[model samples]
Target: MKNIVIVGGGFAGLWAGLTAARELDLHGGAARITLVTKDEYLTVRPRLYEVFSEGLRAPLRPVLEPLGIQLQLGTVQDIDRQQRSVHLSVAGGESLALPYDRLIFTAGSEQRPLEIPGAAKFALNIDTFAAAQTFDRHLQDVLRAPDRPGRLTFIIVGGGFTGIELATEMRTRIRAHSDAATARKARIILIERGNVIGRHLGANPRPAIEAALREAQVEIYFGASVAQIERDAVRLTDDKHIDASTVVVTTGLRANPLVAQLGANTDDHGRVIVDEMLRVNGAHDIFAAGDAACAKADEQHAALMSCQHAIPMGKYAGYNAAHDVLGTPLRPYSQPNYVTCLDLGESGALFTVGWERKPEKSGAVGKQLKQTINTQWIYPPSGSRESILAAADLDGVWPPAV
Candidate 1:
């Protein structure tokens, strides 16, 4: 049997395992699949922001078991490309090596730490579920302190999606925290290096985002950069400083470093350069997807590092990898349509389609759509054998009808 081993349990890794399992199970000629992940659960990373506000999290075992996948809980320490084996450390600290006929590296991205002085030592991040939870606890702890200048001031670095969501949400979260005190007013500030906040989002719906931030009373600083992060304040490039008790950094994200370890072709962000079929260039029996891969979205541009691309890219990579081993014809990966729905907390959301920022919806209607996409659609189906298997089909396109 062809043993297929998949690393990582994020969106890409989970989908890859399911797709490969469905393909191999259908043929059953000679195929087996195993998934190795640092955690036993698949974190809904996109909704991690909601965890602070809504406290919602779903488990992965219920979703994977229905697909007949063997899950190995471990942290991958290194990859042995020549031997086609992965060295991993289990929860108990024991090391084990697992060999595979085909390997898919879907380890996702991590938060990019700032090089500014004291940023690493003091700043907080919302990259992972655990980190988000930690921040929530810290926020609660900050609320207990006496109301002072910096105590009620929360500063967020970066005016992108994550920063916007977090800043706006803090308006409501901090209010709740303040209600527990002597009615202290909280201040939230956002700092962006670009001339305009959400610059990459373009002009069509930029006004809506700005207006929403304004409505939330979330202060935004444009054309500004953080010079250094201090214990009780942040120094700006202009020498001005803001005293803040809570500081969150959401500047941008980069690809996982595992791709570089493979000595494969990679893009500027260190994402593995893959063909349209999602196969690693010049490497046999190896595939990559999600933030770890740089694949063509269409003839014009490469896929962006987002779950929107990762999910579909994973479906394609897993199916194509299994097909290659089964001698089946491969299908080229193509996703010409791209869309983004930015959640702006209580101020609502902005939805845009295509790379040019064509506005689709805004305000309350857009917020409802964003809620559905985040809360209902993005999560995996309950562990129903038939449904889970059906979801694994490579032909299936997510964001259906888009």
Candidate 2:
């Protein structure tokens, strides 16, 4: 029997493992599929900004075990491509090596923390389940402490997707922990180094985003950069100070550093460049997906580091890996359609379509759609192999047929 090893347990890793098992099962091939990761739970990363609770994580065993995919909890220390083995640092500082006939690299991305003065010490982020939970506890601490100036103010560093969602929802989160008057007194401020908001999202949805920000009463500091983060405020590069009790940084994300260990050419974000079949450009018997691989979605756009792209990339990469081991044909990966559904808290949400991001829905309708996606669509099917495999199909419709 051949060994198929997958790294990471997030959306990409989970789906990749499932898809690989499904492919092998369809062909009646006996292959041992194992998914290795640092944690036992699949963190719903997109919802980390919304609220921190146990609901944000789903145990992998309930999903992976029924599919015959062994779950190994550990940190992948290095990949020895020459030896066809992955070195891992498991619990109690023990080391183990797993030789693989085929390797799927799904090691996901991480928050790109800024290297400014006091940032490492004073700034907080909701980049992961643990981090979000820490921030949630900090919010409670804020409520317990005696009243002070700027006690409820939150400074969001960036105007991108995560920053925008967190800023707009800050007040609502506060209200959940305190009174309406306290929530009303809270200040949500967004600081962007760029001149305009949602700079990367293009101009098509700017109007809706701006209106949502205005409705949320989020103050925008356009073209302003934070020089340093203090215990209770952030100092701008221009020597100006914005006092806020809490500072949340949403700078952006970088691909897992393990991509470099494969000795493949990578993009600026440290994502390995892969071929059409999602194989690492210069490596053998190894494939990459999710944030680890910079795969092209189409001729015009490359796959973004989001759930929208990661899920499909996982399916394709998994299928191609199985096919390679089975000496069968591999399918080329391509996703032409793109969409963006941004949650905007009390002002509702914004849903757009295509690479240009043309507005398709907004306000209540968009919020409902966003809620469904965050609460239902993104989670993996559990406790049933049939249902899980069905969801792992290669030609599955994305964004659903609504």
Candidate 3:
């Protein structure tokens, strides 16, 4: 029996294991699959911007075990491609090595930390489940402190998708903890170095985003950068200071560091460059998906570091890896369709379609779709073998006609 080892337990890694197992079962090929991750639960990373809760993660054992895949909890320390092995540091400081005939890399991305002084020590981020919970606890602690100038203030650095969502919803999240008057008095501020908010989102969704920011009463500072993040305030590049109790940095994300260990060509974000088959270029018996691989979604576009691309990329990578091991023809990965649904808090959300991000829905209608995606679409089926495999179907459509 061949051994297939997968790294990470996020959306990409979980789906990759499931899809690979399904493919082997379909072909009646004998294989043993193991997934290495730091935790058993698959952290719903996309929803980390929202309130931290039990719903932010799904147990991987229930999903993987029923698919004839084993789950191993460990942090990957290194990938030895020459020896075809994965080195890991498990609980209690012990090292373990997993050898594989085929290795799938889906380690996912992490927040690109701001290099400014005090940014790392003071500013908080919601890049992981633990970080989000830490932010939540900090909020509770802040509520206990005596009301002061910057006590109820929140300054969100970067006006990108994550920053916007967190800024607009800051009041609502605060309301859940304190009185309505306290929530109403809360100040939410957004700072963007660029001239326009959501510039990365393109022009199509700009109007809606601007309208939503206005409705949310979010203070916007365009063409400005944070020179430093202090304990109780942020110093601007222009020497202006803004007082705030909470500061969040959402500059962007970088591909997982494991991508560099393979000695493969990488993109600007440190993502490994992969061919059409999701196979890592210049590496044998290795494949990558999600944020770890810089694969072309189409001739015109490369896949973004979002769960939208990660889910589908996982399926293709898993399928191709299985076929390569089985001596079958590999299928090229192609996902021409792209969509963006931006949640703008109480003002609702903006849904767009295509590479240009043309607006398709807005207001309450768009918010409904966004909620369904966060609450339903992104989660994998658990405790049911048939449902899990069906959801892993290679021919399935992304966003799944929802």
Measured by lDDT, the strongest candidate is 2
Regions of model 2 farther than 4 Å from truth: none
Least accurate 10 contiguous residues by lDDT in model 1? 175-184
RMSD of each: 1.9, 1.0, 1.0
Using Cα atoms with residue i matched to residue i, what is each candidate's TM-score against the true structure? 0.95, 0.98, 0.98
lDDT of 3 by residue, 1-402 (tens): 888899988888888998998899899878898999999898998788886788898888888989989999999999999999999999999999999999999999999988999987998989998999989888888877997779898888899999999987888888887878888888889989999998889888998888888888899998898899877888998888988888988889999988888899999999999999999998879999998899999999999999999999999888988888889999999899899998999998888999999999988999999999998889987647888888888997667774
Clash-forming residue pairs, model 3: none
lDDT of 1 by residue, 1-402 (tens): 678889888888888888887887787745777889887776777776663753345677888887767889998888898999989999777999999988988988888888889887878988888888878787888888766668778888998888888877776676565573422367788989887877767788788888888888788888887888877788988888888888889988888877776779888778999888888898878899999999999989799878888888888888877888898877888899999888887878888988897878877888898888888777776657888989888877687653
Q: Is candidate 1 or candidate 2 better by TM-score?
A: 2
Ranking of all candidate structures by their lDDT, best first: 2, 3, 1
How much lDDT does each candidate structure score? 0.82, 0.90, 0.89
The local distance difference test score of model 1 is 0.82
How far is 268's C-alpha from truth in model 2 (Å)? 1.4
Worst 10 residues of 2 by lDDT: 393-402
